[model samples]
Target: MGTFSAMHYRCLMPHKPSAHVRRPTPQRPMRVRWWLLWCAMWCLCGAPALAQPAPKVLRYAMVSDATTLDPVSFSDIYSVEVAGSIFEPLYRFDYLARPVTVKPQLAAALPEHSADWREYTVHLKPGVFFADDPAFGGQRREVVAADVVYAIKRIFDPRWKSPQLPNFAAMGLTGLNAVRQRALDQKTPFDYDAPVEGLTAIDRHTLRFRLDKPDPRFIFSLTGTVAAAPVAREVVEHYGDSVGDHPVGSGPFVLASWRKGSQIVLARNPGYREVHYDEEASPDDAEAQAIAQALHGRRLPMVDRVEIAVIDEEQPRWLSFLQQGLDLVLLPGTFAPVAMPGGRLAPNLQRQGIVAQKLARPDVVYTVFNMDDPVVGGYGPAQVALRRAIGLGYDNDEEVRNVRRQLGVPAQSLVPPSTYGYDPALKSEMSTYDPARANALLDLYGYLDRDGDGWRDRPDGSPLVLQYHTDKTLRPFNELWKRRMDGLHLRIDFVPGQWTEQAKAARAGKLMIWFLSWNASAPDADEFLRLAYGPAIGGDNLSRFNLPAFNALYDRQAEMGDGPERLATIAQANRLLLAYLPIKAHVHRLQVSLHWPRLQGYQPHPYLRPFHAYVDVVPNPVNP
Candidate 1:
């Protein structure tokens, strides 16, 4: 474990107001000469002769909305990403964007394990205050050892409603036996059960954690935004239902307000401190330093305010930035100015001294055909026809190279080649979209236009009507699918709504086809295969693809521990999913995003979301 610390010193320097010492009063040439000298002095010292210097605020926008504010309730990347900005965990990843070491966040030092690796001890960082204001009946006080104990307990508290309970139980912590038993036996009220027997307060600034087994990745899990953060125990106990909607955490920003589907505002935490990296500098030096400065002892909204206005449509988000109303915007690469028709967005940005960046996002999009549905049962007549239709339906290569402008690679498998355990050969096995083969297969399958109506009918005399469910988030992709599927005699009906609703329809077997993606900032094949092929992991597994063989393989991979053997098992599972054809990976779109001229630092983090690791957004000019 490496200590994360920063040096602080107060320095008083000369300054002059650049605006007030203006025009030399237009009274004398001598005065103008003196002004030039003063300006030179300001530049040399990195300060103005009569100007005050201070921190600035950074404003940004999100294309997608956060599903839940409750950390323990869900583990979706989007929610976690937002949570990362507002919460603090015990440790984080290194500059390589890997969880190379553990550091203290709410804790003062890295945890120490006993000889058996089942027992652990940790020291808490003293004087860490919650963001809530004490004057408003809120407890804005230093963090204590008991807070950590409470947080770990809440993860398994049935009444607290944490979605991470199962995962927590999987950690095999014997100390939580009492908590689990109490909840199960109804000894404690639904939400009042405290679950850990090993968490004890050595002092106000120290805590100890004892586990039942050796867990090397256990510390990394503490880096997670949800379960690892210590919330205000009093606020949570009293506020109850309102805590999730308005959380009080020990981070740089506090929940100012949320208007639901409209906007969420966060004011800076005055108690934040700039922590220094150890003697060695991490590769994320630039971004890490900026983020540290912005969070520690910085004034709110470096300027007057930082606002994220809600716009349902992506076009307006781009337009607002084009007109200089917004500072930064993240949108799909296809709609980005460079990838847009006639180079629209790029030119506009250049005119305003702004830059448009197309970044390679670790996100993949696919169409999942429910293999377990009665109407779409695997190997059934209807299912076989549907699978054949997919193979001959769309020209993926053409779409990837021309329509999407190679902003993405033609996806042949769920896992991209860049990820661990992903096979490169899977790309060649994907469909080539030959019309002759498609027509012959359809005729052989009894999908013929017997009534001579241009659309083919099944043996049962019903025309094939494919209900394609997609969210409004990717309207462009949906439109392209409709146009591309026209030649297949497929009546593609598009339904655009919220993804959550679509997900519910998928799980209930109401959807014939679903277009969606699994986003992973860390390029791990397990993240993709585990969700797609494994027994429907919550909101994922749109296809309802349940294969005993794949499920067995997935379980074995998880149990195999961290090594090459696990990687091999994952590859086998992915291959099984591909052979079954429950999913058709379309294209691996490159992520593109833009920022205002004022936003100082906005970059991608390889292992996690940008908001998690290192990023800073400051006002254009230093605010006084």
Candidate 2:
């Protein structure tokens, strides 16, 4: 069967041309108009030139589907990936800038802060309009400061059950948490109409944010982040609970069609504001400079449409990419030997104009030993010993060499590479592999063979079986895990399940253990540390770790500016994660993105997700 080119799928979605359509001549004056039109057409162009040009389409694939399209409620990278295309944040990362510089998107400029750094004032660019929607009574609606306020308020509203409530509230937004508490305590609807001193719309285009205390890096929350993208209040109220299904935004693309878990298609927002390509590049960066020079004056989102398919497995996804069904794919490490041997693109692929870019991804793969599980969970010395031993037995280096094909480094801390608070010099037991010590610890903790069954038993003489929940993609990793647990003489079971279902189970506190990775959304370690924060149990803190001392350290670090004091406090939190052993941190992965030559000016930003607007589709006839 003939599949796609993104060209094939674009035809399946609705076509709403953003460009101006030509009006025909009037009825009575038709003959005269036709004569004049023909004369003008003859004078201006030939028959071949009269034909309309095909719309440019870009295509790609992902391993998983987004949890939700709702901008306010999602925490997973997949969901944010979809939301990033459809929503517009106040600020965005500079497309080609190294070190990831934050520049204005909807905001006129960066905010001005008060002397004490407790307040920040931002002015929105005038005439920025939202895409045409029913919520605006069939009229074009310009985005204002109030829309941003409403977006922020939605996170605090209890009805939404947003996972970001703890995150934004911790940013020192003064009345944000109190309002949420009031709604919960009084059992009333969240009062969005009520005044919030911390988040105030000064006027139609100006917004002022007042915080309870100084937060030097709070602006990072506003830059090209899904949490900072503003959705219209009218759209939310009109759609009610179904707003996620009907995402209406002023971003470069509009959600044209969604086939739930199968495919996602987006059309260029014809009504998108007039913006031009003008990204920054370093002096020595030839590739970025060339890309910027070529695309400098073009209108934003050079592609006319985008199609992303959900492809789960490695071999099929790789073959699809090779066959030109998809223009770009995040190349899995399993195929690194074939695609880029010795960290260089193979000659055959290079001859086809296939480009490869690799980096040490700013993320950490970790196994969560659920703190709520009876077998794996507890704060006591015996339980701690069991977790620590398990952590010590598994070798991250082996996984990197044997499983990952030397595409990653053994993770030393919860904080990922290139982010603040990641002390490479600081050592911990997170990556230690000592079977002797692990065996001793297991024996001392009473996790042993009482019935002489070869496998270890619980302290109470019950069966000590560990139920590990994971998706099929991690089967190789799971095999290594099984072998390591065998060394500890511990019995374990692998329960295979879908990512979406298993994630829900993990969040509901029903899973004993699950392996997952957390990629950095911003250039901050705070995102990683949130996994251990007491209040984030139902959110990013999948482990449900709730230690008072650890929580205090997290809070203490958050309150201070980016300096030695904050770094010291963050260090304490990292050490505490090791002591508690709620999670066994593994390797920081190496991300390899392979794309065909047709996808122009494409480069993977370390953490930035919304990059469709920055890339263009100039089809290569040679490849086709």
Candidate 3:
């Protein structure tokens, strides 16, 4: 599964510091002779004469506060990005590889699979130790095969209610689902000690998994940071529900301190295993070559520390990047024009030696209709017609041009570009904008402007009003939606709420219409199709779409390898989704990230969470 971020407008808020903040000391101007004398003395003294401070720390800014440090508890990109540094998945994709390649991280090598493709055995690298924590009784805890088993089992524990349970359940792991059901039926705590035939610790260094069926996409799940990362059992037993607040792992960085919504500090893990930075970049990529030249062969985690501040509002985040308060910033599409005018770097930023990296994200942004809601729910022809009309009325191309500033491509289907199942040749009903056709469809479905109130009424003659759940951050987009709906005499009222609150409401089926984006975690089409799977409702399937045909096709595709058969099934699934109109696919976003010249080896992976192990901080006299 991929990470989803609620689509909303983040208003630019003015940054205000605390009243007790200290002012910096003024620098006195020195004479040219004095400066020349100091330089001469430094040159004469050579390496031992002058002492330099340690390499600079990496200061990054996040748009919102991470909801959790517990990997499986939440699926938000922000949480994944933050927790990823502290956790290590068994396998990770190469940083600069074009055709994504999985490389072992915590595992000694890739898993060896059985002939039937139902069993997988992984061997762990020795000497990997967890960060020092009070939960370990002042002793270093080496990550072992049992730690991996414990981590996977936690997802099945009913008490945790992990959102990733569906992904694991789909694996058809023998005896695991039965255990989850037994615990739920008895209303008792999950028996962590109970043995499941699927998961086994063959030895201190080897872990094995036995699935009931063949699933070629199973390895993709292992590459994700959520269920694959090893977590110490003692630490979870100590912190319990509050484990998100305290994270201990064997990664390049460890969480030093986190102040809720304010700031986060991560220090280099002193006990981390020795790993070096190395990568092969494409010969055509000059930027990659430049980064490789500056950082290749350097020890992992080139920076001493990583400090991140949560600035939910975009204006302050952008200002911080401009004023040098932050070393890197992920520019939102709303502020793309300000940062990169006409799809080119701003002259001012270029003059200041700042670099902007732009790439097409392997993701899709769309508005989902709650299939459980009374007003918009059901699979009847009338309901489907109403949804199709609404989708046709809203102009995604216009939104991309005006709101997104051409920073995205109008989506024809749920699957975004660059993914295995995405079909660029397929044209969808939602991709067209025909107001007359939309109005005709509504009229045919008995939806008309009754009582001459200038708004359509339901078939039952009740007042029809679509309550759109959104945050202040999405005010601009909502305004555009209102205008579009008004043309068809459809009323849409906005219900303002925070991203976190709206996300909770969405999961509870309390939303009529909501906008969000899903970024793929792997290169497979399953990541996108899983969002509409019937069984995934209330989990990744926020829409609660439960079409039986779509569900069957989803299952069929899951069982097949990545081939023509899988692609054919995927096409069938896409057709069903478009026909049902459960979601109005909007666009695939383009990511534009900005960073200082001092920050090197910064490559953006569309699917991979932020990994700073290979990043270095070079001294820049001009920026300093």
Cα-based lDDT for every prediction: 0.61, 0.86, 0.84
Residue 163, candidate 1: alpha-carbon lDDT? 49
lDDT of 3 by residue, 110-134 (tens): 9899877789988989999999999
Q: Ten-residue segment with the worst summed lDDT in candidate 1?
A: 4-13
Tens-place lDDT per residue, model 2, 1-624, is: 333445434434334445686545565675576577665654454323345778888888889988778888788888888788888889888878887888998999999998887899999999999888889998999999999999999999999988877678777787888889999999999999889999999999999999998877777888877777777888988999988888888898999888888898889998998899999888788989998898898898889988989988999899999999999988887898888888899999998888888777889999998898899999999899999999999999999998998889899988988898888887778998999999999999899899998989999999999899977888899999999999889988999998978887787789999999999877889889998888888778899999999988887777787899889888888889999889889999888899988888898888788788989887754543
Clashing pairs in 2: none
TM-score-better candidate, 1 vs 2? 2
Could you estimate the TM-score for every candidate? 0.74, 0.91, 0.90
TM-score of 2: 0.91
Q: Arrange candidates by lDDT, descending.
A: 2, 3, 1
Q: Where is model 2 poorest over a 10-residue stretch in terms of lDDT?
A: 8-17
* Model 1 per-residue lDDT tens digits across residues 1-624: 222222111112234558866655556875666678666654554442455665444456665556666666555565566666567776654433222334466666678877766667777777777665543384457767777667777776767555466456555666675666666797565443343556666778777776666654456556544666776667676667666676767766666677766676666666665544331225566544544555544332233333556565767776776676777776544464353445345564556656455555556777778766554447565566666566557777776666666667777667775566666566444546676666676777777676787777766777676777777656667666776667767567887777656655665667878877777534456556745644443335667677789878865664455688887787678677656677877777765566665664455444555242233454453631
Candidate 2 ranges beyond 4 A from true positions: 1-49, 621-624
